[model samples]
Target: MKNKFTLILVLFLYINLVNCDYYQSKTIVPHDLPNKVTHLHFYYFDIHTGNNPSAVIVARPNQTNEKNPKKSSLYGTVFAIDNPLREGPEETSNVVGNAQGLYVSSSQSEDVTLTMYVDYAFTSGELNGSSFSVLSRNPVREPTRELAVVGGRGKFRMATSFALIRAHFLNVTTGDGIIEYNVTIFHY
Candidate 1:
């Protein structure tokens, strides 16, 4: 009787533990932006997922490991308004991660269009596809272009999306795989 009672208690505890919810803060995460822009816009590139836990991933390499075959670097670009009144002399700059401030000219004011291209290479086994999600800040009245493209080498597919001001994304997969994305954002 004691053995049965203990078994039931253990089973009950196990059920509770296994069913525990995995959750994070419900707040939306905004992408890091540069300081220099009078006007700013963001776009959605892709939504993707993995087939299994070990499939898709993103990573950066250390300096010493840069020469290693398994090592790779990711890159992106950004554009900002140019002003003459600003302290800086450059008319325009490529906005990279963590870059601060936009260039402004003193007497000459111009509305500038910035373009950014993003790329990264990572290791993955099985991949599903890329995904994009609309956030509260997304522009509503604009026409959006959406397309899905599967790669030839890796088990990957990228669903590229063009939205005026949306940035949320979710990735889903069909099989176990990994993918590297090359993204470009341009305004003219």
Candidate 2:
């Protein structure tokens, strides 16, 4: 009888532990940007060259260059984001993370169409190393664009989320700007 009682108690404890609600549901996080610098590399194909007739190219590397050559087809950028732009990242100034991704522009017409895949990462804070990916359309031109959060890692494991992208400052010529991102994620 004693052995049976002990086994039952152990089993009950195991069950309770397994069923614990340690990881809850529906977590919403917002990154407010008063003046967050957005570093973007814009790759453009020469219309005269015809090398890229479609004018489709990849935005890469991750740095900021206003005097980037028009003929160059590759670039990099680093967005420094902190509350007041003074608190940068641990390694850098106030750079919390980065907005890295690809951009595909369809045309230069008034009805411009673009597809973008952007990834957001947190370098410091409780959510350090956590990142989320988003697929957005015409995010730059649109007043409010909703990006689909496909997946994530670290603290955001198995995260299903969305990002609201608002463009505050955009240099149409340089293709650089300061944008705001408000992300809502559901994770385990």
TM-score of each: 0.16, 0.50
Per TM-score, the best of the predicted structures is: 2
Per-residue lDDT over 1-188 for candidate 1, one digit per residue giving the tens place of the 0 to 100 score: 99999999999999987887755336543334222211223222221232322222232223343456573322211113111111111224221211112211111112222222222122221222222221112111223322222121122122223333321322322321111122332211
Tens-digit lDDT track of model 2 for 1-188 = 99999999999999998898876665665433122222221121112113322222333454344565454332232222212111311224455565555556543344445666656666666666877666656535778777777877776676676767666555566554455566677765
lDDT of 2 at 38: 22
Window of ten residues with lowest summed lDDT in model 1:
81-90
Cα deviation at 161, candidate 2, in Å, is 1.7
